[model samples]
Target: MTGLLTDVPVDIDRDAARRAAAEELSDPKYRDARPNFLQQIGQWLGEQLEKLLDGLSSAVPGGIFGLLLVLVLLIVLVVVIRLRTGKIARAAKAERAVFGATRKSADDYRRAAAEAVSAGRYDDAVRDRFRAVVRALEERALLDVRSGRTADEAAAEAGVLLPDVATELRQGARLFDDVHYGGRDGTEAAYRALTELDERCRRARPVAMAGS
Candidate 1:
């Protein structure tokens, strides 16, 4: 009886086992069992991008206003600087014009004195001619050569470069002083001295002009 049982067949359905295994694998719960790391990372990146966009939108208006304010301030500063520079430039030009006019007047008077001496106008030479030369220099602000200044004082202030001519200038001034204040008669000698002084003034004019 034990030997006969060992030769008996067993009933097993292989197709049914395979069909059940396929059905279990095809279930929605089984198919979606594992978490997808790539999908999760994609979702996180999308959320981060939305937050960045929100922050930029919130800041844009204020940033634009600040940039506009800075631009306006810079423009105003440039305009103010330009205006101030123009005012200063105009003031400088006016000063130069005044100085040039004064210099021209001084040169003209010097020339007139020279002409008077050359023409042998002695009486006119001592008074109008020599006086014109001194007045012109004073008017141009070259020196403080005034009527009140003594001949010696004027000559001393005139300096070493003008020493040779300084004596002649002093003599002319002395003659003018004698005629005007000292009640002395104008003579040919006084006239000659005036002519010499006029020559000295002519020579000194260019030097003074150059210095100015």
Candidate 2:
């Protein structure tokens, strides 16, 4: 038994065996199968964030329970932000003027609208073009220049005077409300509609009333 054991020379030491295994696994196939740089970065970041959160949670009295509570709070915050800035945006348009309280003339508003359209800010273009329409009506004595008059009020008042373009006026008013206060993205179609409304209004004469 002693001779047989002595004859069997175990040349593979522990460190040497480890080295051999490492070299074998260092094959191009193994390296190619590993994750790329971006994937590795993402994985490392996830692991670091996990470690940080776990450490924070462990420091709290409720440990993992506290981590759950924090995650819930974060989710709630995101939801609230979406509601405030993304979905509902702000309150009714009545709280503001149709022309945004600016004292620009109808021509000035038209120029402003053109600039906004050039800048690709369709929302601003729609607002400015609609304001130009309202201001033109006021200048021509078609509608009174009342303070705090909303888009809806302006459209209704203008419709009474300009019956031919009543529907278009109401549509432009709704577009104004939809884009400005309803958290909707303005589009070129909406801007063109307003532009057409402005042109039609310019040529429109007041409806003849029985008393007049």
Candidate 3:
């Protein structure tokens, strides 16, 4: 048993072992260890930030162009809306003027008829009176008297409240039309009819307003 133990060679190279260990420690691979997980994540984050800055620098011109396009479109939209609003306002004003003119015309015709009857200017009275009534009815009632509407047609559209004076009103229009268009002579009867029609229009004004 002693000889068997002696036969087993015990390697006692302590100095060599220590030298090998020191050399390994001094090697660059051993001295510079791989970074830990936290350090590696920090390095990766820095690289990504650099890449994002590069992308932003490259896209600056395109971003500016897009902004300008949006601004131009906004300006055009504002101009179009302004022009449309202006047109609408003008149309409203024109409608008001037409209505006001129609009322004034009716009053003028009534006054002219009264003046002619008082002055005994039968021919002039009949003509001026007829024109006044026609202007009023056309403008106020929106009737197209210019296309040569008959006296009965004009009276019906006038809707003058005085149905009792309908005949006299029609007669006045007929006399005016005959003398003005048909070259017939104006007379005393025509003047009388004009005066009666004017009186009827004054009475009927309230009813016309109600209907309107």
Candidate 4:
């Protein structure tokens, strides 16, 4: 009773310590092992099915019916998971379709256009400049050009976000179509016009709606 340890007093708030530990374990930012929602849902469904089957096995007094029920439940779970996964895949594919299959960045296309201008390949410059415009619009979420969409379609969509440049965008889109699809050679003036529109759009900001 007279030991040094007994002579010294220690204070511990047991409830506070327990609460701190619980918070540390439950906090999302600190918890490193969070379960995926889909996987957790599947597991919970399986558990519920297992309990139902157990009750059925006891009440119905037959192994065959329980086995059949388990199989049906498993098939249903598989179908649900597959449908969810397929929907997610389709959404991803749709987003990718908006931007098409180009790996080049907007800056890359813009630089290519400048190089084409220097080489006096006015048609090529026009083509690249129009591509740069589309890429920029896509990056800015101004246009959502899906597969098979024409330059005019892209320009029209972008015009909703940038109405001030609608006329120039339409003109630039026509020039691109002419040089690319209509077998017409592009002139410096045409390429210069596209370049000017591209610069304007790059610097332009969206206008606020009247009522919102």
Candidate number achieving the greatest lDDT relative to the actual structure: 2
Residue-pair clashes per candidate, as listed?
0, 0, 0, 0
| Global lDDT of model 4 | 0.79
Off by over 4 Å in 3: 1-104, 110-121, 138-152, 159-162, 205-212
Q: Give candidate 2 misplaced runs (Cα > 4 Å).
A: 1-96, 209-212
Q: Candidate 3's residue-wise lDDT over 1-212, tens digit each? A: 99999999887698988998899889889757978788999999999987865666566555656556766789999888876678775564343221223244666766776787688766666677776666765655536645435555666656455465666666766787676556676677776677667656655654545676
lDDT of 1: 0.59
**TM per candidate:** 0.34, 0.54, 0.37, 0.50
* Per-residue lDDT of model 2, residues 59-109, tens digit only: 876998987898899999999887776635444333446855457999999
Question: What lDDT tens digits, residue by residue, belong to model 1 across residues 94-139?
Answer: 4322122233354565465456667775444555545555655465
TM-score of 1: 0.34
Q: Each candidate: RMSD to true structure?
A: 23.4, 15.5, 21.0, 21.0
Q: Give candidate 1 regions above 4 Å deviation.
A: 1-125, 145-153, 159-161, 205-212
What residue pairs are clashing in model 4? none
Candidate 4, residues 115-179, lDDT tens digits: the string is 99899899888888888888888787776645655778787888878889988889988898888
Ten-residue segment with the worst summed lDDT in candidate 1? 95-104
Which regions of candidate 4 deviate over 4 angstroms? 1-100, 208-212
In candidate 2, which residue pairs get closer than 3 Å at backbone N, Cα or C atoms, i.e. clash? none
